[model samples]
Target: MPRFFKQPFFAWFSPSPSRLQRRQLRQAIAHIIGDQPSNLDVYQLAVRHTSAAKETKIKGFRESNERLEYLGDAVLGMVIAEYLFKKYPFKDEGFLTEIRSRIVNRESLNGISRKIGLDHLIEYDGQRGRLMPARTSMYGDALEALVGAVYLDKGFNFTRRFILKNLLSHYDLDSIISNNTNFKSRLIEWAQREGKELRFEIISENGSSQYREFIAQLLVNDEPFATGSGYSKKKAEQSAAEKAFEKLELQ
Candidate 1:
């Protein structure tokens, strides 16, 4: 057995009272996933954020959900791509790609994770004074880690079923397809159709290097149509475009 699996802290036969907590955690995870996990430690690690991680002697590096997140990201993309290909056989690649992006975006994933109650189960070091404010993306990252754990414990097919039955079932695909919110693209298309110039300008930047805020302005024919702020230039532009799209009734 691996050192981590042999550790008394995770040993299934440990006589410590923590054994009860571990059992309870396993049950909770089984309930959430609708299937029993063979390697409970992997799932436990999935919910653990880097802020609460501890270094291991074997790896000399902290163990957290990041690695699982990367794996799950690729798995999720593949599953989603396969699903879109099957669902929309006639749809062009651009449409499929755009829809996939919208579905897998950070905000969408965060919302889905929250809806599935994954946010409540996440373990992070919130008490650390130096830790940055909890980001919504953490919940999404944890959710991805959970997917990776599921894939490892169960398999790819089971992971796909979990995503389709538990996660995607909660979303209305018809509504999502009908109500595309690529405001920036829509605004640009509208501008091109009307033979008007459209541009985005970064008006200001503020905050620390780690968490800088950007303000963006959307201009139509050199006239400012709307202004918005976000954590990144792309986000700010998207917000500005959204506001402009709504105000101008472009859609």
Candidate 2:
């Protein structure tokens, strides 16, 4: 039996067992993964904490999730790219890129992470009680690290299966196509059908280099439709266009 079964277990003790003790725990993860996870080190690397994880480095190097996060990001991109290619055979490169971006975006990754109880796997010294909702990067990054681990341990086929089973299973193809198409592309398509002129322009810039900001204005038929701001020029344009689209009630 595991030491966790020895009684008087700490509430803060690992939610997932240590690597050596994961035969049973990982079995469930395996079913979730559709394969046995052989790289305990890689898994550990995913959930490890770094000084950058917080403001200080009270723990050692192995504690940080950086290395595993790097690996996981690559693995995730590869699997998602492959999936998009197969799923959208007739789609152009730009169209496929849009869908892939939506699937692997931070929001989607975080959603999937929560489903896997990834928060339970992270070990941190920060005050759990006072932590705000926004400081949950560990959960998102850990998911990516897990992907990296899966790729390194089991190879691409297993990783692809895991992605298809757990993550891609939830997305609707048509919905993704409708929602994730670029604002510019979608707007142009609508305009072409309606025979109207549309334009986008950068309005202003704000903030410093470390945190630059952009404001964009959208024009429909040479009149201002909407304005929005974001961390980048492109994002501002997208936001402005989305607002304009909403205002026009054009899907």
Q: Pick the candidate with the highest TM-score.
A: 1
Clashing pairs in 1: none
Instruction: Give the distance in Å from residue 86's predicted Cα in candidate 2 to where it truly belongs.
Output: 1.8
Q: Model 1, 1-251: lDDT tens per residue?
A: 11232332223222222777678768878987998889998988888777767677878788889999999989988899999999999999988998887678776777777777666566666565364323447878988999999999999999999988888887778888898687899888888989999999999999999999999999888998899899999999999998886577444
The TM-scores of all predictions, comma-separated, are 0.68, 0.61
Q: Which residue pairs clash within candidate 2? A: 48-63, 49-63, 49-64, 50-64, 72-148
Alpha-carbon runs more than 4 Å astray in model 1: 1-17, 129-135, 180-251
Model 2 over residues 112-161: C-alpha lDDT tens digits?
Answer: 77676555555554543453334445567778878877888888887888
Residue 130's lDDT in candidate 1: 62
Candidate 2 lDDT at 18 equals 53
Cα lDDT of candidate 1 equals: 0.80
Where does candidate 1 have its weakest 10-residue lDDT segment?
1-10
